[model samples]
Target: MSVKKTKVHLISGFLGTGKTTALKSLMAQKDPNEKWVIIVNEFGEIGIDGAVLSDNGIPVAEIAGGCLCCTAGPQLGNTVQKMLRDAKPDRLMIEASGLAHAASVIDELKVKPLSEELEIAAVFTVVDPRQFVSPDYAQQALYKDQIGVCDVLVASKTDLCTPEVMAEFHEQAAKLFPPKAKVVEVQNARLDIQWLDIPVIEKPRYRLKAEVLPDNTMGFQSEGFTFPAGQDFDGERLTHFFNDLPKMTEGLVRAKGVFQVLGTWVWLNWVDGQWGANQVSWRRDSRFELIAKSFDADLIEQKLKEALE
Candidate 1:
């Protein structure tokens, strides 16, 4: 009997860094014969990434409500162990929370039962070039630590960044960090599969914090609502609701979820100032996640409830 060791890839990045977009591209190019599993963790209580990944027909496990560094760590381990026992995938990919500490996740993977059956393939850190211009981001601990912990650095959304921003990021990234295996730019999160083949040789220098990660430490809050199972939202009404979200909610950052729309389900996504929605396969529970720096959760919930009425 031969033992199969699953190759595990950890995808890390700050919020809006295109980790999910990159995963979409990778999944599109997956070999037909290979069985791959993805575990998605979101900082928000309402799980959105799992819905997005589930559209691809891949096996997905979700750890939501907190980061893998703390609250979701045990869930992550249990999910991995179960997947290994049942699915027996050829590879495993984890999309951790944007604010998550990659070093802590790696530390978790290296412990006990998971370490016995899994091999660390690569840790990829995604960067949004636009963030390079933010002086505050340069000062953030999670942003800086995310960069420090990856074997490969991927600058995503290249098409959206100006030439000068790209040039500046390239020059600064090279000078700032320790030498890594690879640093590449990807347009629309189109990552190369060859990078995934590289084995993890050097572990990250950032150590996991011994203390519990403080609540709302990232200065962002998430409020989510689950709609009743039998209710269905009118498409026009839902669109109107999302269109008005940015204007109504104070400090609104990102919103995502699946809603039951007239016997069909549609996924709506909003980030920064833009919103988009598309019809998707049906999901029983209709819900939404609102991420903000500050907001009146009750008011937002009222607005959504009225929209469905």
Candidate 2:
């Protein structure tokens, strides 16, 4: 008898491109009868994405501290093996770190024993249109590799983009050598669940250039902080702090945190100059993490402390 293989889907995107939001959207639409599991990888040691996703009441395995494409590859494989033997879910979803080389992750998954038990259903890459058209982001080697490795190209945060930006996104996407199976726009990372079933089209695999090192060596640094449950932040001051983060710190690219603010809990997200805080039911200890080109961690911690209630 042929062994039953579990279907797996990989979601990849650059820093702050809304991969977690997209994963949440997909999870919300999952089949009630089917058991599903999520594996989230983060560049920060604190594993904020895993914490946020766990709130949905699903079992989440987190691989933190490095990119799964390189340094964390062994851990990722082990996690998959353990999940398969224990949870035995009907489907599996992996949210690759924003800075990950997705092509390498895919290659890892297709190897030997793991490949025999897992079938890659589809690969999705989320893109922020504003960044997609920007020369700075477009020129990045990892950014281009993420796009090249996916079956579906997702344009997230479309609601915040201008018409010109959207047009340019289409123009650039059209220029990709091997066209994507589908290119769709989404608002707030609300991807259509049906897209997950899109058939995978075989394409030339993307290989990383030798000179490209792991994320830690790529000039990016990350810092994470956790506060005890009773701690609360001054909402007004916290908002101001996030709003002025780019000016207050150099090379800050992405920052996210869940904090007890005023009398309730709120989740704050800041990416490339856009940010918002929304009330949430999360009751865990407050935590914050930021990824940057470089920053004074001591000073950032001091500023955060000053915003406490």
**lDDT tens string, model 1, 2-104?**
5678988889998988999888888988998989999999999999989999987789999999999898878888899999999999999999899897767
Clashing pairs in 2: none
Clash number for each model: 0, 0
What stretches of model 2 exceed 4 Å from their correct place?
A: 202-309
lDDT of each: 0.77, 0.80
Candidate 1 residue runs with Cα over 4 Å from true position:
199-309
Best by lDDT: 2
Overall local distance difference test of candidate 2: 0.80
User: Can you give the lDDT of residue 151 in candidate 1?
Assistant: 76
As for model 1, its CA RMSD to the true structure in angstroms is 17.8
Q: After best superposition, candidate 1 residue 173: deviation in angstroms?
A: 1.8
